[model samples]
Target: MNLGTYLTRSARYWPDETVLVCGERTWSYRQLDCRTNQLAAALIGRGLRPGDAVASLAWNRGELVETEFALYKAGLMRAPVNARLGRGEITHILRYAPVRVLVFDAAHREDALAAIAAAGTDCLPVPLDDVPGDDVPGDDAPSDEIPAAGPVGVPYADLLAEGTGDPVAVEVDEDEPCVLNFTSGSTGALKAAVQTFGNRLANMRKQLMSDESRPRPGTRYLACGPITHATGMGLLAGVFGGSTTHVLPAWSPEAFLETVEKERITATFLVPAMLTMVLAHPGAADRDLSSLTSLRIGGAPIAPQRLREAVALFGPIVAQGYGLGETTSVVAGLTGQDIARAVTEDPELLQSCGRAAYDTEIRVVDEAGRELGPREVGEVIVRGPDCVREYWQEPELSAETFKDGWVHTGDLAWMREDGYLFLVDRKKDMIISGGFNIYCTEVEAALYEHPAVREACVVGVPDERWGEAVKAVVVTHEGRAVTPGELIEFCAGRLDRYKKPRSVEFVPELPHNRNGKLDRKAVREPYWADAARRVN
Candidate 1:
């Protein structure tokens, strides 16, 4: 079934049930379904056809959710742009996707218009400010003028009101593409990954069946991250299971906790860094987080100590998962039982990302793509229905990324005898010194064991003799100080001499990408600015 069918089914089963909650506003499934149908009829009235692309530049709100269902009903692919990106980046995605119509909320209207202008594409803009807001932002604010670009200009409300005489019936195949998600590439380009209806359905099924993935009706889901990423789309899985979503326009440690207490949020997904920020917030101690039942975290590995502290503060609700944009969301998850085992029995297992999902098959393979034995570190490859078949418009890269039937994740990991998978580091993040491969995560894990260290990122810097030397960027706890020599000594005691960082730089914090992963590209770009090749 298509992703849009979920709305129809929910509307049928629980028509009057509240489906979405944005701040003080709430939308029933019946209201949402009817409104989206009207919006779809509006899009059809404007000449949008099957397979046409509809892009939206907006934050998490009722309108954004409406546009998703509307585009699905219209049989058009929805391409949600990353609102955090600059105009140039947005322009590249729009040009690459070549969308037929673009929708922008009032907050992002200027950037969306700028991106369309830069791409030299004629797009019909739907001004969300003109729509009747209900307890959400712009509820009582004056309607702002939305600059017109195309001849057919209509307010979002007026278009919804002028519904078509009959809903146009369109054939939708389960394998048809429904969403286009763009990922940052190694060469600084955007790689659009097409998510099929079947892929999304498979993800929803897997998540709904998992014992640790339960979200009851009326459960409040807090979405604080960028909706363009995989985590953002994964939040929809919660909605599919009959939960209400609460959106945060932006990330703020104080606001995150306040919303949790105020909204009585039951579940949320955050990256490790964002979780750390929430824990460090002064208001966190004062907030009542007893309502939370599940806190799914991923995007990066969580330190053991940090995991312990999170469990201490939030109860045993924080679960970790491992996956990438190409996987359509989660491939492996550390469930509540796994968390309990790690905390009560074996603390070392807390560092692992647990086993593969029920629908996924994971294996560690060598350089020649040969399957490796347990405890042997190699490339982590996975094959499943949820995995993407190929990257859009890149035959060569697609061939290299997908071999045989497995999708090469480019992440180095090893499986234990108990079937748990432990992520070492990214293949590119491994530091090679005098032909010896050193995983950055190993060094960082050791560094985090230091009492004074709060966070650490390790990368290979250019060296004249060793080809590449280990370098670390560290963030210390408040009122704590660790000299470079002292940290180097700390690593020397726990790790091999070659694995120890030759230099250490203490900084306030490390830079993170939109998905909350360490921005190693940004960190290494400056050091290798004049280098001939990225590799020494």
Candidate 2:
């Protein structure tokens, strides 16, 4: 069935139920459905067809969600661009995707128009601010919302309001593409991973049935991250199960905590960096978070100490989800049981992402693609219904990514005897020193155990003597101090001599990509600028 049908079905069953909440505005399922239908008719009138692409450059807001449903209803593939990107980067994506229609919020109007002009693509800009924000109440006057300063061609409200005809019926195959999500190119250039309706449905089913995955009816979910990313798309799991989504336009430690208490949010997903900021916030101690049922975190590994502190502050509902854009959001999730296991049996287990989800087959394979046994490190390969079949318009890359029947994750990992999978590092991120392979994650994990270290990232730098040398970038706890010698000594006690970092650099925070994953490439680029290639 088409994904649009999911919204229609839900609307029919629970017409008056709150479907979306942003600030003070709330939209019932029926109201949302009608708006999407009107927007879909408008899109069709504008010449959008099945398989045509429509892109949105916006944050997590009510209008963004409305555009998604409208695109689905119109049978157009939705491509939500990362608003953080500059004009050049945005232009490249528009040129690559060749979308027919582009939507932009006031905040990103300049970049969107610049991208459209640079790409020379036929794109109609739909200003988001002019759209009605009259669902519930509480925010500033809606009349004050002006068209974001750019080439304002059409107002989204005008288009929706002008189209008063009945919604057109569009037939969509289950295998038909629904969304196009771009990968955060931390290691290489970004590629669009096309996700199908069937893939999303399968992923949602796995999450809902998982022993640790549960969201009560009318649960409030605060979306503070970029909705254009996989983590944002994963919020559909909450929507499918009947939960209200509260959107935070941007990430702010103070605002995030305040929203949680004010909205009585039951669940929210955050990256490790965001979590660190929330914990560091001055008001965090006074915030009432008893209503939170789950604090979902992923995109990077969490330090054991940080995990402990999060549990201490928010109870045991901390959930870790493991996946990529290619996995359509979640491949494996560390549930409450998994967190409890980490607290009791082996805290180190918390460092490892939980076992593969039901319906997913995970295998660690050697360089020749030979399957490895438990405790043996190799590239993690996943074969599941949720896995993307191919990258958009890149047949050669698709072949390299998908081999036999499993999708090569390019991530190095090992499985324990208990069936838990431990991520070591990205294969590209692995540092080779003196012909010895050292996984950055292993070294980072060891460094994170230090009392003074709040966050750590490891990368390899060029060394004339050793061919490559390990380097550590650390973020120390507030008011705490640690010298480079002390950090090296700390790692020496936990890691092998060669595996330990040869140099340590203390920084306030490590650089992160748009998706919130540690940008090892950015961290190592300066040191490897004169080298032949960034990696060995």
Per lDDT, the best of the predicted structures is: 2
- Across 374-396, the per-residue lDDT of candidate 1 in tens digits comes to 89999999988888877877898
lDDT, candidate 2, at 371: 87
lDDT against the true structure, per candidate, is 0.79, 0.79
What's the distance in Å from true for residue 481, model 2? 1.4
lDDT (tens digit, per residue) of candidate 2 on 433-457? 8999898888887887788887888
User: Mind sharing the TM-score for model 2?
Assistant: 0.93
Superposed Cα deviation of residue 166, candidate 1 (Å): 7.3
Q: Which stretches of candidate 1 lie over 4 Å from their true place?
A: 130-153, 164-169, 531-536
Best by TM-score: 2
Report the Cα lDDT for residue 82, model 2: 77
